[model samples]
Each structure stands twice: as C-alpha cells, then as structure tokens.
Target: MWYLGSWMFPVISAAMWLGMLLGMFIYWEAIGHPIYPSMDRGQTIAYISDVGAYKLKPLFIAGACVTTVFLDLGFLAERWLRHAGRLAPNTSRAQKVLSVIAILFAIAGSAGLILLSNFDTYHYPRLHDAFLLLFIGGYWFSAIFLCAEYQRLGIHYRSHHILRLSFWVKLTFIIVEFVLAVVFASTSYTGKPNVAAVFEWVVALVFTFYVLSFLLDLLPSVRTSHHQPQGWALKAEMEKAHHGGQQPGAPLTNDSAGPNQNRHVAPGDDLEAGAYRGTSMTNGPGYPAEHNDLGRQKRRGIGRLWS
Candidate 1:
C-alpha cells in the first residue's frame, strides 16, 4: 500500500477551512443573526468577511494563513513528485510552461488570501476588497493553466485516465466558480447586499471542493509494488548492493510499456532480445533463426578482431 502521508496536507487544509467557515456562520447565527451593514435589518444574509472582520478576526486570520500555506505546500509537493518521476512526467514544453505558470498563480492567490485576512474589511475595506479580487482571480487563472496542461497530458498519455479526470474536475471548478464570482460581484455592486452575501458564502463553500481536488492529481503517485523505489529507498538499495558485493538490478525504464518488456528498443533497431549482456545481445531459445545467426556472426567477428 502507498504511504498516505502526503494525502494529509490537502485534507487538513480543506477540513480546517470548512470548519472555520462553519464555525463563523454558527457564531454569526448565535449572535442574533444581525443584518449586514448598509442593508435593511430584515435581511439576515451577511458576507463571510463581514462575520470574520470583527470579533472572529483571529480565527479568520489563522484559518486563512494555515489553509493557504498547506494548500501551497501541497501544490509544490505535487510538482516535485511529477518532476521526480513518482508521477507522470510532463512530456511537452508547453505542459512544463503551463505547470510553472499555474504554480506562480497559486502562490499569488495564497499571498492575496493572507493579505486579505490581515487587512480586514472592517477597517481597510478597499484594500481588503482588492486582495479579495487578487485571491479569486489568481486561483481561477491557476486552475485555467492546470486544465490546459492536464488536457495536453491526457491526450499524450491516453492510458493514464486520471489526467483526463483531473482536467475535467479543474475545468468544472473553473466554470462554476467564475460564474458564481461574477454574480457575487454584480450583486455586491448593485445594492443587492443580501444576495451578494449569500453568493459569497456559496463561493467559499465551493472553493473548499477545489482545494480538495489536488488529491486527485496526487493519486497516481501512490507507491505500488510495480513502481520503482525513489529517493531514500533508492539510496538504501544502492548501499545494500555495495555492502553485499552484488550488482544492483536494472531500474524500470518504461512503466506504461508492459511488465515483461524490460529492455528499451531504440528507433529502427531490429533486435529482438531481452537486453545486451556484457558485449553481445542475449539470443535466447525463442529468438528467430536470423537473429541467432547474427548473434553468432558478431561473436565470431569479435573473437577474430581480438585475436
């Protein structure tokens, strides 16, 4: 079974975010469920920032800081895993570029979230609103880049259906969040404070789903018996071979090719054998007559040249 330690980061981030928001809502409701500022007293809807801006400011700051930090770390770790070949490697130059761009946007989004938490809407309404835009826009743009990269990767690596699934998941999140954000902003600016507040909460709730979506991207990295060992395991294997006076076995060259196909075939090569042994190909019992003849001829030629 794969060690699931990496899975916990995003899970913790999502759980903390959901718990914090739910706690804020419950706190607001318990406190007489007052109307938002600049709205009629009959209107009970209040923006997350409104509820978070006053007495629960510390909770908001802490939650935002912790959530974004863990989320960023999860993304960074996912990128590292892909590069380290624990996950699928990005085969195209565009895919690599898109990946870097996505990470940059994610970092910007995390920064925006932290900034917004620090600059509360109660005091720095303008700065808070600006940071809110940065936060929303940065993450949405990040998702857009990720969707593009995953789409390309899915097309190239058809067997790994997880890439396709991840692309669709991020695409759906992008579309839904974009629409909700537009409506939320429109309502906020059009004097529909209650409607905006309702949409705001809906947006935050939906974002929790997006935050958790990273788990899908990371699922393919789960170490299995078939997978090649990595990092410390690789080092330990090498050290054991050194102390034991035995040569280490060849590493897996192609994971998607097939289990029995251990040898790599170069383009235009006609050889059909397991692998090269020392100086000659291993022409086994099942090899074709022509290949066997060629192997014998090569051995004779080498013997004559050496003599």
Candidate 2:
C-alpha cells in the first residue's frame, strides 16, 4: 500500500539514528575516551568527529545521517503528493502553492543538513552554524505547511483519527523544539554551555522519536484502498501460474476462484487485494495519487510535470 511506502524513509531513518548512536558508543569504547551523550561538553555531537582517535566513526555516522535526511525529504514529498494529487485541483490555488513550497523547504533542509554535517564545527564554524539554522528554519516552515495540508485532508476523512493526531503532534513538537532552542541560546549567554548542549541533544532525540512514530501506520490492519492493484490483474497473474490459458478477467464468481477456497462463494468484488499491493505497485515512489478530485485521472506523471 502507498501508506507503507510513505513510511519507508521514516522507519529507515529512525533505525539509522539508533545505529549511529550505538556506533558512537562503540567508537568511544575503542578509543578509551567516552563521549557522553547527555553531558554538556561545550560541543555538539558532530564535533566528536574532529577528535584524533575515533574520527572515522562519528564522521561516517554524520555522513550516513545526512544521506538519511535526504532520503527522508523524498518521503515527505511523497506524502505531500497524496494530498496534492487528491485535493489540490479541487481546492484553492493557495493550498497548492503552499504544498509545493513545503516540498521545496524540505529539500532545502536536507541540503542544509548535508552541509552542516560535512563542514564540521571545528573546520567551518560559521558555515556550520548557518546550515544548522537553515536546517531548523526550513523544516519548521515545511512542517507548518504540511500540517495545513493535513488539515485539508482531515476535513474529508474525519474518521481518520491518525491524521488529526499527527497534525497536533507535529505542532506540539515544533513548539517544544523552538522553546528548547531559546533555552539553548539563553544557556550560552549565561555561561552554561553544558546545559545548552544538553538542550541540543534533547531536541535531536525528540526528533528521532518523532520520526519513529511514522511506523504506526504499518501497525494497523486497516484495509488500505490507497494503492491496491485491481481485482482483474491479480487473477490474471494467478491464472498464468496455473496455466489455465484464461485471459485475465474478473473472478469467476465462485468459491473456487475466490480468495478463500474453503469458504462459500463471495462475490468477486469481495476478494481481498492487500497482499498483492506491495510497495512495488505504487504510482512511482514519490507520486501518491493517480486520480484527482474531479474524477479525472492520470497515470502518475504522464501529465505535465508541474501539474
């Protein structure tokens, strides 16, 4: 289902974060010098790479995280396309513009993260700080717009509790992140770099956990209508396997041709398709809806690129 593909980057990136944290600890053990995650060492996590003994570990981790952020941006764009493709045409032009802007902002944030990671704090403090600010600010703007899109979608699917919950959680997280940022700034002025660093780590950790929640969609056994293959296609593939020499058509309307052979005959239309609608059955990785709100449809990106 498209919902599962939508979670691809979030789940992968969350696991990457966990792996990097573990790698850091292992590297510290090897070097015989600990880099405390919670302690305020007047340095950010990226600064760990500048040290002589275990430079490769943290450096590699930063690079990997940068790659993960880039990939996550694509996932965010894919998620945005769900609404853009479904509702933007019927909705106001302002909403469409906002969605595109949010996608661009996400891309910008990902690029900033790459620069921030590669240009270490020790080597290019000014450049590093600039990209760091870009990363935070760009993502904030992106999230604000994405939440607006969710608001539009939630209006149609009021029964979808998860969409509304995601909206509120994102808003709350953004508020907390900004508050922690202010506290971090104050700590610097108060000569408490340690506390400031701790705030920074808290912000990062909160983001990681926020990302982990993306897997929640996969947990539910909800019948996904989002990206399922047509009933005819599945039957065709099955018939080919059995050498039935039958052209792919709708089910035979008999129990023999239904999903469960042991059960009494259910209509062909009642057959399940979730198992066949894996991520490969998507309308491309980044394009979510093949149908627009007006009942007209395109085969994914067969239409104008901007459209």
Best by TM-score: 1
Pairs in clash, predicted candidate 1: none
TM-score of each: 0.72, 0.58
Candidate 1 per-residue lDDT over residues 92-198, each given as its tens digit: 88888998899999999999998998898878889999999999999999999989999998897676677899899999999999999999999888878889889
Worst 10 residues of 1 by lDDT: 273-282
Candidate 1 C-alpha RMSD relative to the actual structure: 11.3
Compose the digit string of candidate 2's lDDT tens values, residues 1-307. Answer: 5556445666677766656655654665576655544234554433222331235535544645654573565445444544444211214566566667777887787777667667666567678778778877877787788668657755754655666676677677678888987897688558786566557657666767656655442222223555332223333454686755655574544455434445554345432243221112333336554433321224443343323
Per-residue lDDT for 289 in model 2?
A: 45
Candidate 2 lDDT at 93 equals 66
Q: Which stretches of candidate 2 lie over 4 Å from their true place?
A: 1-4, 29-54, 57-90, 213-307
lDDT of each: 0.81, 0.56
Best by lDDT: 1
